[model samples]
Target: MMHPLSMPELPSGIARVQFEPERVDYAAPEASGRQGGVQAGWPLWLATFELEKVDRDSADMWRGFIARLRGRQRLFLASDPTRLYPKAAPRGFAGMVRAGGGAFNGSAIAWAQNVDADGNADIGLTGLPEGLALSVGDFIGFKWDATGAAAGTYGRRTMARVVIPGVVSNAGAVTVGIEPPLDMLVVPAGAIAHLDRPACLMRQIPDRSSIGSIGTGGALSGAVLVAGQDLRP
Candidate 1:
């Protein structure tokens, strides 16, 4: 079996995707002899995406074939809808995704999807029991299956590590943001900064989950959009 990474050349129409968050100055101007202070706000998250054509034959064996070639891709978000609340995931949040066999072809490559917790995945921003409330020093850390979560199984799949620092903390019906800054797929670098013509349709599920269909808009907020397609050599 030829490894996708080992392939010397990809299909003619295929391309790679890449993206990075736009860097901004966190330091604020100072009234004294020191540098400026940082304004109280969240950093802008940037994600990039690309598209390319893949040989269906070779793609069938590619580790990323499923996510890059499958019918539709999914994205999940846990939020309070108020943009300032400690959000809780619905029952069996990650489990439901696992049951769907999220990626059909990628399983052989160990790209299967799995979450750490069995039921609801909750994020605590503060000890407050009322409306939404998070402290200024609080950080968003993943304690469940988030740690060591990768893409492949049996040494054939890819892995993804997702982490985010808490930029918003307040108590009063707040909504948490779940924008990831990276992708496990091998997309072109240009795809992360622009929007596609189709405008990619977004699907929201009851579990506070969302997914972007392929060839439509699989890339997320931080991801840029490129014209090339995924490749399979």
Candidate 2:
């Protein structure tokens, strides 16, 4: 029998390009619209990516992975909503604004993204650890690893939502485009994006009455997923 680790050959209709949003700074005029007036700053430039439903087998596999990534178990990373805020000292800029929580309005428990060399990608949840609890609108942060590297090398990580924006991916190909066009109504209000630390390992999984160390004694902390799209499919 084939070992469970022996991932099945991906079936047809599976796109492998993973997309994520990057946190960027933005500025706005003061309420009075006058000079020397206080201004509000927030995070913008939320990108997007699509998780093509590959074949029935691939889809099922992806579905399970996504379930775990977005699962209810709390994860601690290098970054969170607090760091996602605007770096500049702009007045009226609040930290950790809650807009519901989790993708699909909290219906799902976990989330994650994975991409291939050909730009093929997938994003979704796997499952939540048993006996874990999470309330709606709770603040979560993610530390994105920014150091790009070759396959198997450690790099930054970020948590973004899967937004199929007019892109199509099948078994062996990937296509990308803007879902909500820039300078348009693509990004929602009060949204921000940021990257996690390198090799962003999800360790120290919390249990019913204690936390367990899975990697480096770190925990898996959930972050506010604003929105994201892949530039390439």
The candidate maximizing TM-score is 2
| Model 1 whole-model lDDT (C-alpha atoms) | 0.24
The 10-residue segment with the lowest total lDDT in model 1: 193-202
Give model 2 RMSD, 1 decimal.
20.5
Q: What tens digits encode model 2's per-residue C-alpha lDDT throughout 1-233?
A: 11111112322222222223333434545788754422233222232112332444445454444344344242223222222322221122234221232222112233333455643444332232222222221212222222243433223232332233211122112222221122112222222222111112232221211111122322222212223211110
* Model 1: how far residue 125 lies from native, Å: 22
Cα lDDT listed for each candidate: 0.24, 0.26
What ranges in model 2 sit over 4 Å off?
Answer: 1-27, 30-47, 72-233
| Residue range 130-152, candidate 1, lDDT tens digits | 32223332223211112243433
User: How many residue pairs clash per model?
Assistant: 54, 56
